[model samples]
Target: MKIATYNVNGVNGRLPVLLRWLDEAAPDIVCLQELKAPQEKFPEQAITDAGYNAIWHGQKSWNGVAILSRGLEIEEVMRGLPGDEEDTQSRYIEAKIAGLRVGCLYLPNGNPAPGPKLDYKMGWFERLKAHSAELLQLDEPVVLTGDYNVMPTELDVYKPERWVDDALFRPEVREAFHSLVAQGWTDAIRKLYPDQKIYTFWDYFRNAYGRDAGLRIDHFLLSPHLDKRLLAAGVNREVRGWEKTSDHAPVWIELTAGG
Candidate 1:
């Protein structure tokens, strides 16, 4: 089965581009982030017509997440991340599709760091780590996939030194990401192509895409059982170049069935 994750930026604004990619890629299941729309505003019919059933958690003009499954019923697992009752951002959604448990998330983009935003980001990371630890106990074929908004290592960014002050690449954030992985989750893309300069996001400014000034922020973390089934993984980098496309491209992983 092929499963993918994409941060659509805005589902309504980029529906056409998304539909095109869906037709072209035909992933069995997809986890989407950054819907940037209210619950009533989600273009459900358009997505349904594209041959997928979906469940989404949307907020007004900001963070949102969804899961779409082709030719299968999506059993809702949860809507938001646990451990923060006061946190109301629609950044997480989980579901069971095609025998796999999938968690889709759009982690906070804590820019202009050394402030409250960075604090929130770190706190969220801690919450996610606690929640992930619980999920690990399930020992099922699971995938935690989404735009983590983190450049995990020096190789994950185009210029590591230049992004030192950036929240996404800060040492604390990177260490948090590493600590999450150390909880027995495998970074699918990096595991598949360790030495390659793979990237999934690029800034729209300064001709970043043309210069390949990108970051590998989106990720798929597989449970040990699922990792064994991983057959292939990669970024659909060309999707970033399409007209009116999102800054993030799609990242995908193919797995053998019944692992």
Candidate 2:
């Protein structure tokens, strides 16, 4: 099965691009982030017409997440991450599809660090760590896939020194990512192409995409069982060049039917 993740930025505004990609890529399962729409505003019919069933958690003009499955029912697992009752952002959503437990997340950007935003980012990371530990004990095929908003290592960024002060590349953020992967979750893309300079996101400013100045922030972390099924992984870099497209391109992994 082919599983993919994309940060659509705004589902309504980019529906055409999304549909076109869906037709072209035809992934069996897709996780989308950054819906930027209210619950009532989601274009359910349009998505349904594209040959997929979906479940989404929408928030007004900000964070949101969804999972779409082609020719299959997506059983809702949960909405929103555990460990924070006061947190109301629609940034995390979980579902079961194709015998895998999938968690889609849009982690906080936390720009202009050394402040409250950074604190919240770190706090959220801790919560995710705690919950990830619990998921690890399940002994089932699991995939944590989404726009992580983190550069796991210098290898993931165009220029390591250039993002020294950036929240996404800060030591603490990378450390948090390390802590999660240390739990035996396999980063599918990195594991597939360890030495290649692969990237999934580029800034619109400074002609970053044209210059190939990008970062690998979106990811697919497979639990041990699922990792064994990973067959191929790559970034659809051309999607980022589409007209009115999002800053992020789609990242995907192909998995064998059974482990």
Candidate 3:
């Protein structure tokens, strides 16, 4: 089965491009981020017409996530990341489908570091770490996929030095990501293309895509049970070139049947 993650930027504005990609890629399951719409504003009918059943957590004008499954039952397990009852952003959604526990998240961007935003980002990371550890204890086939918003390593960035101090590439942020993967989860893309500079996102400014200046922020982290099932993975790079497309391209992975 194939699973993919895409940060749509603004789902409504990019609905056409999204539908087009869905038609072409035909992934069995998809995790979408950045819906930028309210709960009642999600385009459910349009997505349903594309032959997928979906469950989404949406917030107005920013941060939302959703999971879509093609012909499979999507049993929503959670709408928000656990451990933070006061947190209200719609940044996570988890579901059970095809015998797999799937988590879709949009980690906070945490820009203008050395401030409250960065503090919230780190706090959220801590919560994620706590929750992820619990998920691992379940010992099931699990895949946490989404626009993580952190580059994770120098190799994941186009120009290492240029992004050193940026929120997404800051040392602490990358360390947090590495720390997450260190908990026995396989970074699927890196596992397949160890040394390759594979990127999943490009900025809309400064001719980033045209110059191939990108970052591998979106990712899939698989639990031990599904590690050996990983077969193939890639970035649909051309999708970034589409008119009005998101800065992020679709990142996908193929897994063998029966993990």
Candidate 4:
């Protein structure tokens, strides 16, 4: 089975590119972030016409997640993280497709750091860690995938020092991310391309994409069940160069089988 994750930036704005990639990549399951629309606003018929069944958690003009599968029934599991009831971002959605518990997360890109946003980012990480711990105990096939926003390591970024002050590359933020992987989640991309600096996002500024100056923030983490099933991992870079495209590309993995 082929599974993929993409930060679409906005579903409506990039619908064509998304559709094209979905056809070209042929991922059996696709997890999307930054839908940037309410649940009712999602183009249900359009997606269905393309032979996909989807489940989405959406908000107005920002932060939404969805899972799309071809000829598959999606069972919604959870909507928001478990840290604070007051925290109301549509950044997370869990679902079951083909008996694999999959989580699509748009982790906070806490900018202008050393402030409340950063604090919230760390807090959200804790919540994810707690939730992931519970899921890990299940010991079933699972995939935690999306634009995690935290760079897994310095090698994953272009200039580690330049990003030192940013939330995505900050030590504290990365540490919190590390805590999640420590709970028996396999960083699937790293497993395939350990030393290569494979980038999944390119800024829309200063010819970032043209120059190949990008970051590898998007990820796919598998549970122990996938460790043996892991077959391949990849980043679809050509999609990022399309007109009015998202900064992030699609990251994907293939498994030998799934229940």
Q: Rate the local accuracy (lDDT) of all candidates.
A: 0.94, 0.94, 0.94, 0.91
| Candidate 4 RMSD to the real structure | 1.0
lDDT (tens digit, per residue) of candidate 2 on 160-231: 999999999999999999999999899999898998999999999999999999999999999999877889
**Clash counts for all predictions:** 0, 0, 0, 0
* Global fold similarity of model 1 (TM-score): 0.99
lDDT minimum window of 10 residues, candidate 3: 162-171
Candidate 1 error regions (>4 Å): none
Better of 3 and 4 by lDDT: 3
Would you estimate the TM-scores of all the predictions? Answer: 0.99, 0.99, 0.99, 0.98
Model 2 C-alpha lDDT versus the unseen true structure: 0.94
Superposed model 4: Cα runs more than 4 Å off: none
For residue 45, give model 3's deviation from the true position in Å.
0.5
Per-residue alpha-carbon lDDT of candidate 4 for residues 132-185, written as tens digits (9 for 90 to 100): 999899967889999999888988998888888888998898888888998898
| Candidate 3: count of backbone clashes, pairs at least 3 residues apart or interchain | 0
**C-alpha RMSD values across all candidates:** 0.7, 0.7, 0.7, 1.0
lDDT of 3 by residue, 1-259 (tens): 9999999999999999999999999999999999999999999999999999999999999999999999999999999988889999999999999999999999999988878888889888988988899999996899999988999888999989998778898889989998999998999999999999999998888999999999999999999999999999999999999999999999999999983
Model 4 — which ten-residue stretch has the worst lDDT?
A: 250-259
